[model samples]
Target: MSAPVIAIDAMGGDFGPHCIVPASLACLAEIPSLHLALVGQTPLIEKLIDRQPGVDRARLQIVHASEVVAMSDRPAQALRGKPDASMRVALEMVRQGRAQACVSAGNTGALMALSRYVLKTLPGIDRPAMMAALPTRAGSCHLLDLGANVDCNAEHLYQFAVMGSVAAETLGVRRPRVALLNVGTEEIKGNQQVKLAASLLRQAPGLNFIGFIEGDGVYRGDADVVVCDGFVGNILLKSSEGLAEMVAEKIRDLFSRNLASRLLGAVALPLLRSLREELKPATHNGASFLGLQGVVVKSHGGAAEDAFQSAIRRALVEIHENLPQRLHGRLEDLLL
Candidate 1:
């Protein structure tokens, strides 16, 4: 296969080019076949590139985007007002086939709105959903609709299940166990929407439908693909992140109580470090906007250099797997 080219929205995140530039350059250095198009104000991006020594100018190019989508900008404003925004320009590159994928740390709403408008959705997919691999006890699991469609009917949830299953399989899960996120694992526990979605999933041909999974079951790794509406998924994800941070801080506080505790902490440092590395959000920062006609990966807006690099790497993996095409093929068999 040929080397993949990725378009990076260098001006989309909180730190903009400062973080993205180094991340892009590091990815380029590590993967000689990778090419990057940094989209932002040409002069500013050029200056950053110039500051970094031994950069392979041949593989990295600048794509000028006169405007930037602010984090506070609403989706409608971003779609209509900023025609030349770095986020839009990068997605446009994917739509126009100028790049195999687009990676951005821009406003989530803007990115989703622009992605749907620019790339459209694959056949049989009503809307695009954000999917990410989160750390779980059984290694990891793919969670979807992470804030895409807040209001979803049973049909929409059903589609998310199919799409999520395909995504997991592509990522190396063998017939992944699919489950619906609900108040309880019992069939009579959830609201009307969850019950209806569960019914639809049960009937999906060839799907490894494992019934309802409570929120706690997610981390326990009870299912390989957890399906829920955007509202529920987003809240679950945010709460998990906050809880993880709090626990980590509490651990540190306990370790620093006294000299004896500090000594114990020293002895346990390596194990703690390993646990932190496994659970850190930055290690799993990239979230794929699935169902789009092309590949688009969203990095956390506050992502640091390594975190942003994880997002770029996610895009590269999708490019290599031809994720959009795989979904298209699977949808034809499952949906159509």
Candidate 2:
């Protein structure tokens, strides 16, 4: 079999090709069989490519895209206006079967809209939920609708639950425990939509619904999958990211306070480094747009080189697992 090829939106993110080029180099070095198609303005991408000496050019190819979808552009505007945008071009490669997956640290809305437009939803899927890996005490949990369907109904949330369950299984959990994010654990808690969704999940045959999980319970390793509407999920994701940054900063401040503290920090440096690594958002930067026919990974727009590499790694996993195909089969079995 030929090596897996990933299409990357080279000019998509805040740092653009500056970060992506180095990340691509690292990925290529780490995974020998991986090929990368960096789609964007040729000149800019070439400039970064020129910076890396003795790199294997054969495994890396650049597909030129004239326009770019800015982070500030509305999804509708981007969809209509920038037909040649880097993000669009990358997804196009996936649609054409030129690449197994597409990775973009671009505008989330534009990526989702363009991906849906290009790849379409999987059979039986009404909409694709933005699913991502969230750090938890029990290793990691899959959270869905990170910001895709803001006004989801019970049926939509139910679909997210089903997709999340499949995703968790793909990520190595068998018969993953699923939960709905709510204000309380009681069946009576939450709005009508959540309550109704919970009812549907409970009635889902073969689904291991573990009841409701509050915001406080999310990181406590309570469940393998946490399902919620995009609005709530987005808020939780950003809030947790901000809180992790704050806590890490506070630890740095605490360690730098005085000579004695500095000495203590030296003694505990390795442990502190490990803890910091666990808390960093970059380590868990990629979000999978589940329920789509093609594999699409959304990297943080402000991601650094290492973070972008992480997103590429994520796309590799999904591609190798043939996640979309597996998910389609699972959806067929459960929903049909």
Candidate 3:
């Protein structure tokens, strides 16, 4: 059977045509019977298509968008001024049933904001969280509200646990472990918000709550789901990113110091590659803006072609899995 179609925001990321074009081509090659609605300037997308060798030009169509939302623009203002933006057009395609899902490596804040304004949240889901799977020393762990709603309440966090739990189920984990990010593991050890959230989650039926998870809990691999509001979560995400970058830089520096270091590096190439594979953020390029009516993946700003391809592939799996329908079924239980 043919796979469902997807809409791609062709003009969103730092690299724009350079990254998006190759990524879409890669996606088309991998996903048989997949169709794409290229949401951007029609002529630009056409020009890119014309240059590719042995391309199945019929599989792609251009949906012209007039404006582009800048990475620096405020979400509210950008949405108001750029109604015909590439991201907006891509989302509209999903809304109109012309596409199964929408993927973009663009303005994350704008994407989350517009998705909320355009798609709205499901019942009992007041705020949608930007959830990402972080690569850990043990394995990959889930972190919610990476940079979406900065200030969230205890109830919002509880809801995130529910949504995150559903995500774990879709990802094939049974009875997923849930943990609240706090300063302490004690039930009353956190701020008033976290304290209240702890009580709620503890009492929340259906969720496999494992109590409070501190910052150290993340690296310790103590929980499957790490829960926090956007502000705190964003900080944690950036902190992890910064540390990863630092470690990679340090490794490179160590390997570049004259003949002895070079020889050591050459001898350990396979080991280093294995470590890189485990540490690569781009291994999972797309993260969903969960709680929307349909699947929406947001890629990294500087995502390379490989990262973009990985993201599109992830979108395909999410679409095929019918995550939304399943999530809806699990909603009442999620709403505690």
Error of 1 at 3 (Å): 2.2
Order of the predicted models by lDDT, top scorer first: 1, 2, 3
lDDT of 3 by residue, 1-336 (tens): 365888999998999977798789878877668888788988888888888887776787788998898888899977899999999988988888788899999899999888888777877788888877877666778889787888888898888888887876776667888999988887668888888888888887778999988898787778888889999988887777777777777887788798999889777755776666456564345787778888888888888888888778777777887877677778866562
* Ranking of candidates on TM-score, top first: 1, 2, 3
Worst 10 residues of 2 by lDDT: 275-284
TM-scores across all candidates?
A: 0.97, 0.96, 0.94
**TM-score between candidate 3 and the true structure:** 0.94
RMSD of each: 1.3, 1.4, 1.8
| Residue pairs whose backbone atoms clash in candidate 1 | none
For candidate 3, list the clashing residue pairs, or say none: none
State the lDDT of candidate 2 residue by residue for 1-336, as single tens digits: 478899999987898888888898889888888999999999998988888887788999999999999999999989999999999999999999999999999999999999999999998999999988787887878888899989999999999999999888887898999999999998789999999999889889888999999987888989989999999998988888788888777887888899999888778776777766666553457889999989999998988888888899889989989999989988888788
Candidate number achieving the greatest TM-score relative to the actual structure: 1
